[model samples]
Target: MSDRDASTPRVILARHGETEWTINGRYTGITELELTPRGEQQVLSTGKLLVGTGKLIDPVQLERVFVSPRRRARKTFELLFGTESELAALNKVEFTEDIAEWGYGAYEGLFGEEIVARRNEQGLDTERPWDIWKDGCEGGESSEQATQRLDSLINRIRDIQRPYMHGEKPVDIVLVAHGHILRAFAKRWLGVPMGSPLAMMLPPGAIGVLSYEEHDINAPAFLVGIALPLEEK
Candidate 1:
């Protein structure tokens, strides 16, 4: 085991608040959507929860406040941290494309019930039902495809966080993204199969924390923290 002080950098992932589609149980991907009033409230609650935890971020020590380059996610950031002027003053946050939500492909605008109804109309195996993963939505991304995207994003995060594990630099990351993507991310980070994400459910406006334990600089270490409920303010 590498001998280093206990403070290893970690990631705190937050799901963006509800959007119009989200409120209606539609799968949102690639399409930019705005937050509803309740969504905005959730974002504010998240901000208060974070600040109230007394885990006040040391701006200089944090690497970046990475966020998905999507309107809902970006808006959550804006609401939580304020507008452009404040973000510039904070200086450690940045937007990243890798953290974008799952691409829903043709099913981007469809609700789960709609997809199932379509499946029934087509005489497709309704026994299994329609899921984003497993059976997948026709003309859209399969669970595997979604998993691949999540893996790539998690890999980027690992690349940056590895140095902190080795005591090379103090790097902390916070990601603001979507619910499904965050679930996929947590599973991918644990080296779990993406289908396993079906077992890991989170609500909109939830927070998931990931922590790591170091054994070697390059070896896969322990995931000390997994998904946990945020202070539901």
Candidate 2:
């Protein structure tokens, strides 16, 4: 257990690059999709901005990297981190289903409008708009289920950093996953309920930072920064 600085350990949540379904605004949960050409380029650009010496994220300070089991997320990690040789030399990367995209289930591969129309036809509570956070997928995880799993993951992360909590060493972790799940993770990090009306938009390949306040490990965590695409900047 290395000694960590008083600063709360940080977690960098990176959403995977664009995919065919992402470009089309379709539900791609649990679907194996590759990054588009533009997606690949954009993520590469982000890597230059966020990773490396004096960058927002210092690669040498990273303790561990967690990635979604999905190919898109894995590919994004590779692109942002380094080449094969470079990645192999750094901290080991672990792929976990815990960070995978939300399970869309019956609503998989459908556009937002399509999901609402289908739900109406099936008479599955169509009185209101289809809000995944509130309604969840008919055959997928509910808000409770998602929150439970994410909370479990968060606890694991905190445990990993416990040994380094009071030291000067950096104990940062990186999560490469999907948009919805990462967004939800950020909210849960702040101890916010899943049903809360928190409007957070993480574009493809964007990086969102989470850390504690006042350099206190036990302090409430909050978003420190969100790195947008180079073009957007």
Candidate 3:
């Protein structure tokens, strides 16, 4: 076990706020969509609660940020971190395709009911229904593919954070991306199989925390906390 004073590297996973497709329950993979007015407000509120000094995520401790290439995710990163000048002054931000949402392929823009209907029409088995974790979209990424990409990303993060784990530097990384991809990333962070059931669901603008246990670099990683929107009085 590492010393108690050792700093634990952490990754904060922020899911983008609502889009038209998200609100409508449509599969929005690789589709560019702007945030609704409410979505923008939701992210703004989340930023206030979660980001900055003494907040859930301290800005000074943040080393870098990884963002999905999608517009919604980009907008969320912008809003959460402030204007371009502000973000540039704080941490290095990079847009990565690896962090993009699941490639929905033929299922893109289709609602769950519509996907089921389409499967029935195509003579595909509808008995178990469509679970993205089990039955990946045709012509798109499979569960194994998603797992591989996420694992690769995780490895990169570990490489970046390992040096900081001994308390030489504080490491806090932020990932702004889609709902499905972020949740899957969390599952992989815990070394869980893609085929295993995931009980965690991140709503629009939610923030999930991933960190090492006991501040030991070799310790098992776990989901630390999830920050959700405050209930309106």
Name the candidate that leads on lDDT.
3
lDDT of 3: 0.84
Better candidate by TM-score, 1 or 2: 2
| Candidates in descending TM-score order | 3, 2, 1
Give lDDT tens digits, candidate 1, residues 131-225.
56566667766778877777776677788887667446767677889987787777777777776443766677777666565524344333444
Q: lDDT tens digits, residues 56-95, model 2?
A: 6777667788899999998998899776625456645778
Best candidate according to TM-score: 3
Clashes of each: 0, 6, 0
lDDT of 1 at 188: 74
Please give, for residues 78-130, the per-residue lDDT of candidate 3 as tens digits.
Answer: 89988753556654788998899999999899889998888889988757767
Query: What are the models' TM-scores?
Result: 0.79, 0.88, 0.89
- Look at candidate 1 and tell me the lDDT of residue 141: 68
Scored by lDDT, model 2 comes in at 0.82
Candidate 2, position 104, lDDT: 88
